[model samples]
Target: MNLDDDIALAHALADAAGAVIRPYFRARFVQEAKADASPVTQADREAEEAIRALIEEHRAGDGIIGEEYGAARADAERVWVLDPIDGTRAFIGGRPIFGTLIALMIEGHPVLGVIDQPISSERWIGAAGRPTRFNGKPAGTRACPELSRALFATTAPWFCGGFEALRSAAGDTLLGGDCYNYALLASGHGDLVVEEGLKLHDWAALLPVVEGAGGRMTDWHGQSLHKGSDGRVVAVGDPALLPQVLELLER
Candidate 1:
């Protein structure tokens, strides 16, 4: 398979999702509570449908794991993981930090990922063996060797363990950026991101985006993230901070 072809398809998928999402931003819409009590809106469902439709038309054989819709052909060798609106709360609150997350998993490993912020029209695409790009320009993380000098980001404190310790250790902290935090980290805007309770669709797309931009992402235990990860994830713009971050997380 031509990797470029797949990468192009990934961009198209993001475009499709963005098109569906832009109209709903800050517009009147009803939000419903899911079984897990998380918010879901029409934009989330419609955007995922748009993305799934494009994947079906172009890559019919591939599997799909979506946030709104359940899995289809999940055992296939190649699967697409999608989260139409990763930060529904932020989206509902008219915040632009929510993003559309898309990832192509080949044989259970993510090979490409896209994080698209529809309202801002900022896109970050990352593929294995290639530099990450933000709006067609190469994006990279900055060097911050120590946690005390890092700018930390997370959506909420409840999703993280040792939140107070880590927050206090970091040089600066900003809250509420959902998947966009990873995009910022990839673009040298942030230094660290740590969160828990993320689903595959929530984080699968982040691995490639973070890793391809001179950053590292792993579980709280410092293991590689995979389909079975426990949802505790930590991302650092500089890998040197991982050990220190992990130590504080264990406290």
Candidate 2:
């Protein structure tokens, strides 16, 4: 398969999904929950359905694993991992930090990823062997040499066990959800993004974006993430800073 062609398609799909989601964002809407107790909104379901329909029409054989509606067509070698609205809480609160996340996994590895923040008109896209870009400009992680200078973001304090260690290492901290933090990390704005309780959809779309931007991402144990991860993710711009943060967290 031509990876670039696939990545471009993924980027277009993400943008389409974002357009479907942007209108209902923060608007009056009903809220509900999934079996796992995560919040779901009208925007979430609508966006997922729109994206699913588009994917089915264009790539009939590809599988899809979505946050709002669950997995479908799971046997295909190329699967799309999607979080229709990565930061639902932020979206509900009228914050523009929320985004639409889409990732293509071949075999068991992510090959292309896109994070579209419709509210801000910002799009980040990356592929395994291609350059990462933000709104069509090449982007990369910052060059922070030490942990003390790193800016960190986490979904929440309760989600991860290594908060204290991260706090100790990072001079500043910001709280946010899902792909937004990863978007910031890839755009050279944030130095590190660490979280726990992540699912495949949460980190899959983000892996290529981070790695393509000269950063590193893995589970807490420093293992490469897969479709069945236990929901822990640690990402940083500089490779040198990763081991130090990992060592501190593991301690």
Candidate 3:
């Protein structure tokens, strides 16, 4: 499939997964703890299963790496990375910040991405070499220039190695999870988002969205992100501001 077709397929998949997850938002459900002590609910598993099923049926030869179910069909050149419900804690607590994240990674680089927030009725899609869009209209990142004027965000304060330094740099901070912060960054509503303690599924889908919207998405070390990375994720609106922040972290 061509890039547009692939991006369309990803959007469809994200919409389908959102359909499965939206009903559970703000509704009480059985919540359980994973071995890692993170919370999981029927919504999380069911949404992931739904997305995986779509990928398996529609792109049978492609591999998948999902947050809830782990990896499947690992050797395919094109892989679908999924985070069915990126902000489970927010979902469980009746917050609308949660969303479904999906991406197509071809030969290890994210080329297409979708972040669907059903509650807000917002969907952001991005593909390599194409403009980023929100519900089909073009979108771009905010134009914050320096740390002193930037609005930084993260899932929590403790996730990044340079949390103290970043907090000190930004004019304001928005504490939240992956997809929500990514959406804000893409919409020109937030300037920077730093995430640490992430798996490939968490960051993979976000790379295309951030980059396509004229922003930078990379590990804290100023290196490109990969499936094997476990360091902090630093996303920023202006590419010019990223290296400065990265250098601060490296100090």
Maximum-TM-score candidate: 1
Where's the lowest-lDDT run of ten residues in candidate 3? Answer: 225-234
- Which lDDT tens digits does candidate 3 get at residues 1-251? 78767776887788788888878777768899999999999999998998888888888989999999999986688999998988899899888888888989888888988888988899888888988899889999978888899998888887767878888888988887657898889989999888788888878888888898999898888888876777578899998789879888888
lDDT of 1: 0.93
- TM-score of each candidate? 0.98, 0.96, 0.96
Give the candidate number with the greatest lDDT.
1
What's the lDDT for all of these models? 0.93, 0.86, 0.86
Give the Å error, residue 151, model 3.
Answer: 0.5
Clashing pairs in 3: none
Error of 3 at 165 (Å): 1.1
lDDT ranking from best to worst? 1, 2, 3
User: Stretches of candidate 3 above 4 Å error?
Assistant: none
Which residue ranges in model 1 land beyond 4 Å of their true spot?
A: none
Error of 3 at 86 (Å): 0.2
RMSD of 1: 0.8
